[model samples]
Target: MITVSAPPPPPPPQPQPPAGHAAAPEPARGRRWPTVVTSLVLLALLMFAQSFRFPNDSAVTEPMVASGDASAAVDAGSFTVKVDEVRFAKAIGDGAEDSGLSDFAPETEYIEANGVWVVVFMEVTATEKQLTTFESRLDSGDENVYASTSWLYNTFGSVDDGFPPGIPIKGAAAFEVPEKALKDPVVQMTISSGPGQRLAGEAHVKLGLSGDELKKAIDGAEETLDVPAPEMQKV
Candidate 1:
């Protein structure tokens, strides 16, 4: 009986799974945000290496009339002027160390003194030689030399002909005066003797308040030139 039972048991201890084959693999971990953050940092570094350097200096200077406190001037009375256009010219004088303003030129010159706005145009003339030199000299990096605006406590007037009187002519025109005019108001303009060099001619138009009439009109008003455009028309 024992022999028979042993024989049956020995038939087969069911094959046990080979060593580790039956063990399940551990659960895998998911992706983390640190990996994503690392990728973004790398991308940012690449983009930062790409950006413009600014220029060191500016050659042209803006005109003065455009600079001053327009608010104050507008507040004064009936202060209205419209500058439609402007002109310039260049000129040179013989044996002169500098052409002064003779090199500056303008194309048209006229003054429009209508309601609420005043515009002035003056002819300009400049020779070829003068212009060449002016161009070379205008290449400045300073605010003092080629500055565009000047102030006079009193009044500025043009002594030229063909100008009308009582038309509020007692004031300066905020026009562009070339380098020549900057040196001295009383300067000489001459012709140039060079190939392809032609005579320079032009006019300058300026805009500003008719200091004479505007000042007089404003003195009477409680709030003079300071009046706005809509209110100025009423005056």
Candidate 2:
């Protein structure tokens, strides 16, 4: 009949961890799945980003171009040219026997065009040096490029020799091109020699030809275009 025996001695007190030792970690399962999923998501995002490619400046190698309309001056750093006039012809000749440079008579050298011959007269002046070389081309509306014919060499003012410093030199070049070229014709002039025009400054002039105007010029083109010898301009 004494009061109920005192509750069993208090359960033994739990022991404290030794100094500096960590308590046990939580079960790994709880954190493992979330960590793995986060890692996988990051990896997937990285892979997805790698799938696309972008364009940069390295892909462009075209020359720097100065563009203008016919009769306008287009300067290309190295030199400048003005499209003074444009003419069309079916055939062209020098009409002279002696060019002084050679005994070669250009009078008998009449060249017939497969399509139509376009003649361009330009006033050129060198900005960088008195010496410069030029190669000409036609960038046509039909996406065709026609190079200037060498047959006109010496017959017309030859820029082949280049222009003097400061003073403008008169010259002309001929290109045999399809009628479609006139639809949106552009004359491209490149400085020739050395590495050959790549990455260099180039001149482009829109000839202002298309539709009826183009047709009229083509239809009325001369049968045989003859011109006097090209002369150098005086300062």
Best by TM-score: 2
Instruction: Give lDDT tens digits, candidate 1, residues 43-149.
Output: 78766654222233221221112111222211111112222222221211111112375356332222221111111222212211122111101111122223222
Show the colliding residue pairs in model 2.
none
Instruction: List lDDT for all candidates, in order.
Output: 0.24, 0.74
User: Considering summed lDDT, which 10 consecutive residues are worst modelled in model 2?
Assistant: 153-162
Which runs of model 1 end up more than 4 angstroms from their true locations?
Answer: 1-78, 91-142, 145-156, 159-235
Which candidate achieves the best lDDT against the true structure?
2
Candidate 1 least-lDDT 10 residues: 226-235
Local error of candidate 1 at residue 26 (angstroms): 66
Query: Candidate 1: TM-score?
Result: 0.17
Q: How many clashes in candidate 2?
A: 0
